[model samples]
Target: MKVLVTGGSGFIASWIRKELAARGHSVLVMDHQDRRQNLAPDEEFFLGDVRDATAVTEAAAHVDGIIHLAAVLGTQETISNPRPSAETNILGSLNVFEAAAQYGLPVVYAGVGNHAFRLVGTGCYTITKSAAEDLARMYNLYRDGGRITIVRPVNAYGPGQSIAKPYGTSKVRKILPALTCRALIGSPIEVYGDGTQISDCVYVEDVARAFVTALEHTAVNGPTEKPVEVGPLTSVTVNDIAAMVAGHAAAVTGRPVVDLVHLPMRPGEIPNAVVSSDTSTLQQIGMTAADFVPLAEGIRRTVDYYATQWLPGWLQGMQVSA
Candidate 1:
């Protein structure tokens, strides 16, 4: 099978590229040039912004299916610059789906969990992603010759993720305190609030695998029955995730996590955001969350990956707070 994985240079999509390649499929990766340094040898890497219809259309030409993962994904970043975020995330995604619609291919759209509910603070990012997800559904409903499945992953962490990158992070307040105890950094990790908010996380590799699986299964699209929702999904708390990261950092780096200090929570934030999956829908395709890697193992792998690959640059970018 021929497959196109958008944002293939990203931590998560990079793993998706590997998974697709390992499964004996021809893989093409479309990512921004700035992120190409980590491009693996097996992928036919294409460097171009998704905002360009010609570029995405050209990339889409070679693949039988699409896994759309490219987006400007972060609340602070998107909120700070909503226009560009909307252009890249919402408009750019439409281009991808448009090409797929033109080419008659099935598409798996990456949707955000936060958009499942109304959150006040991160409205900019949530609204944009939610709109993009709708675009996929609308295309699937009316367009000819393709299927669309919206996969909303909560807080996914794994080998390719970086805690240091500013785009996305669990909104738990105690993470910094836990990081301070681990001495993972020279300064305290930033905390936004009281650290008790709950969230869920999935493993990136698992998510990537699901992306491929969604394509392989025919039930993901149909007129005979409802769409099949692929699985390997799990929901976990932000505080629990922070503690796990802290403990993992301690064991790997030999430091203890300190207690998180109280801080003002971000405005318009959801105290708890969880997603509902149609388990029966997923099981029809022989997918389940049981295949997911447990949080402890996933965290250990994530901490180790960040420590080796992303932490040096992350730590270097930090300045001591005056």
Candidate 2:
């Protein structure tokens, strides 16, 4: 199969691209920026944005299916600037759907599991993502046929994820990378609110497999049925995550301890929210929680990755080019 993956340079998309290529599928990556280093030799790349219909159409022309993953992420980033988030997540997604509809291509959309039930807060990131999911459903209903499959993934973490430069930067907001980096550098790990807000953190490789499965699955369609929830069957609180990161850091680097600093939760933050995998949907897709990487093990791998792989390359990039 020839698969077109939007935002192929992103963390999850990177894994999806590699997985598809490994499964003997030719991949065509379309992203606004060039992160060609993540691509395999058998994969092709196109510099394009999902917002541009022409670009999206050109990219989807010869692809057997589409995995739509391009969008502005981060709750803080989206809440801080809603316009661009709306433009990119909503309008940009519409362009992708329209193009896919034109080409009669099957689409596998990446959505947030949190929004699968009820949105606790009105964060722009969730709002725009939910809107895009609606657009995907609409396209499926009114277009050639219902050839869309929605995969709602929980908080996905792993190596190759983007992190703030200069190491230990406070601007790093993603939970996993932020905690991992702070623990490695002996900085206090910041936890928002009471540190009890629950999240289901799935490994990137697992999420990548779910996307590939959804793209190939012929039974997914329409918006009436619930989207397939991909993640661990259990949930962990924020405080639990902090402790896990600290423990993994200690184990990996032989550190004595790591401190947790409680901070007031930011605006648009959901309190007491928990995300869990829908077993029925997973069963339908022939997946189970046992197939996922254990949280503690995943955390340990992530800590090592940031400490060894990501941090060193970032520091090297900062060196003066003479």
Candidate 3:
């Protein structure tokens, strides 16, 4: 199949593109960046944003299926600039759905952490993702024969994950990037609000494979209202993550042991962000425990990436804290 992948230049979609090629498929990517390196001969790029309906339609055309990964990402980033977030996450999703319905193409969408057990948070990112999920379900309902499978992945981390870059009105705050920035230099890892807030994180490759498997299987399963939860079986608190990354930094790079410094919780943040108790779709796709990179191994890999690829540039730009 030749798939149209929205947000194709983003971290997660980059992996999805690789998975597609591995599965004997080609991809046409629509994103803000041009990611031309190492693409399959048939794989193509459409440099555009999902917010542009005309561009989305143009990119959506002639694809066998659609993998909708584009969105205004980040909890705090979206909350800080709600208008653009709404335009992209909500309206951009609508454009994709409409195009899919018009073309009678199957859709595999990216959702936030599972809501089957409990909602992850009550921020703009959570609200907009939920709204988009609702819109997806509605599209499946109204459009006869329209199929849409949603994958709800927890905080995804791995090699290609970028550091906190300018995203919307606020800069992004990814756990691994921030922790890595400090841990690599033997500086204190900042932990907000006693560091007890829980989060379930998945490797980017595993998340990508989950999306590919869902796309390959959705035809057999049909569009289920219940999203496929993708992530680890275990949940870790912020404190746990801090310690693990710190240990990896020391072992992986000979960095000194790091400590955690507690800070006030950011506004609109949730205490716990975990996966649902329901059977994760990774299981449904027949991925055994062996398929997942163990948390330690994953962190070690991420640490290596930062220690080599990231830290060199980051060190040059890093301003000394006053």
Q: What is the TM-score of each candidate against the true structure?
A: 0.82, 0.91, 0.90
- Model 3: runs farther than 4 Å from truth? 33-41, 114-121, 165-170, 272-277, 288-290, 316-322
Minimal lDDT window, size 10, model 3 = 162-171
| TM-score between model 1 and native | 0.82
- How high a TM-score does candidate 2 get? 0.91
| Candidate 2 per-residue lDDT over residues 68-167, each given as its tens digit | 9998876777778888879988998888888877877888888887783334575688889898888877776777755677888888999977776446
| lDDT value, candidate 3, whole model | 0.79
Q: What's the lDDT for all of these models?
A: 0.66, 0.80, 0.79
**Candidate 3's error at 35, in angstroms?**
4.7
The deviation in Å at residue 105 for candidate 2 is 0.9
With candidate 1 superimposed using the best TM-score fit, by how many Å does residue 120's alpha carbon deviate from the native? 5.4
